[model samples]
Target: MDWDKLRIFHAVADAGSLTHAGESLHLSQSAVSRQIRALEESLNTTLFRRHARGLILTEQGELLFEATRTMTKRLDATAARIRDSEDEVFGELRVTTTLGFGTLWLLPRLPRLFALYPNLKIDLMLEEKLLDLPMREADVAIRMKEPSQAELIRRRLMDVRICFYANADYVARNGMPETAEALADHRLITQSPSSPQVRAGLEFSQPFVAAANHSAMTVNTYFGILQGVIHGIGIGSLPDYVTADFPDLVRVLPDVQSATIPVYLAYVEELRHSKRVCAFRDFVLEEIQSFRRRALPEAPETGHAMTP
Candidate 1:
């Protein structure tokens, strides 16, 4: 009910220390403590359990803090929307994507985006865990599959094929594996079978796992696997898009590849009008087009398409 007290309580709960929260809010510790006490009194319950070490939120405090957190995010979203109405794209845009695509595909092309919008701030969150879009976990996401979450504005960027790759020297030394049986002669470096990756990638690598004579060295991230493959550790399973950037890595079995893994770019419906989101979406689309041109120079230049 009291916005000021709620704000102070949220800060204290977030920081877990009255002194730290007071410093952040530019208020005295006594002032912050008084507000928290008043809030607890008004709510008729204990908000925090004070200890010599720090403050810990009680069950009631946790509930109130969750409410305040939601309120804070909504207010921030409103402010961002208001700022988005301006002509400048100059705020933090949190973008989430898989580790492999973020490091291999997106990071390399981000310079062009920075050149276009010099003031834009990008917070690239690279991990396999799918963040909650509508809850504002991230501003945008480039994912390996269509997002199952409703109320999201999603666009399919491209389809990636995961396949076997090896360092040129490794292939030169061991020769290429022409058949599934031939894989038995070479060591395999790939994403851990237990790691979270696209279904298509996992399915494509299963037979190779069984066929490789040596037990695979499994890295959790594609970047790690790529490094292993680059250093001549062994043949690796990786996205086909990698070859366009990594020239020294050769496709292990040209005839064999994974089923197409659809890549989708998504954001909350609330950001549909945000200039930062628009700038990022367009930048990604243009880069995907450029990547396609480089990957297939002979293919007729049918420009990239957007699905509603």
Candidate 2:
């Protein structure tokens, strides 16, 4: 019934694991368990059915979740309203992104963000795997592919162009490709293999000759892959924005045969009205828009135009 208990309940419901929910709330596993137990006892119903992975909500828990969600939203709105009156942006903002984007783009820009809002703290979570924002692992997410559903809010920040790049040494030794079809001639470094259809985020028209994991001089991290490409290790398909600063890593070919990717800034419906969330969201959008304008002068004229 209390705000704290409801918050813990929501966390348990979302994370489905004590350890994860505890990490999100900055509480110990025992503390989280106690809170949830107290909450269920107060409610006089079996809210959760504990399992090996975590706890699943019972039918009553599911029903109560609807009301709890509404209550939490209103409570957050009230807090935000008070903070606005006080003229302070103070809260924890959980953000998620991929390895490359997280290391290359976001990590460097965080100092400026802290200077802008001294009271606000940021929790950055990076995963190769996708995260569900509505479930509360992340407050904001930057994803590559287009959002599947129309219900979620998404703003395309950039028309991400992809092409092959490699270090000067690798290119000098193995040689560079003149066309997209010519990439087959050289050695290629990659991270972990994806689905049978996708390899290193590229779907080859023909077949690829060879690949490597981390040990094969193939790395998965953005910085790692970029370093390999810079050192002339091997060629790999990478986002143009990712390799823009590294002069050592040059594009293999000028042609844009690789798939067009989008960099998106998205959040959950629950945080639509949150001041801290919206402030950061709007700031990122403004910055990205300026970057897009500078980077893609003829974006509309070209086939790489972004959709509304």
- Measured against the true structure, the TM-scores of the candidates, in listed sequence, are 0.95, 0.66
Q: How many clashing residue pairs are found in candidate 1?
A: 0
The candidate maximizing lDDT is 1
TM-score result, candidate 1: 0.95
Error of 1 at 56 (Å): 1.4
lDDT of 1 at 195: 88
lDDT of each model, Cα atoms only? 0.88, 0.68
Query: What are the RMSDs of all candidates, in order?
Result: 1.9, 6.1
Where in model 1 is the C-alpha error above 4 Å?
A: 297-307
Superposing every Cα of model 1 onto the true structure, what RMSD results? Answer: 1.9
Cα-lDDT of candidate 2: 0.68
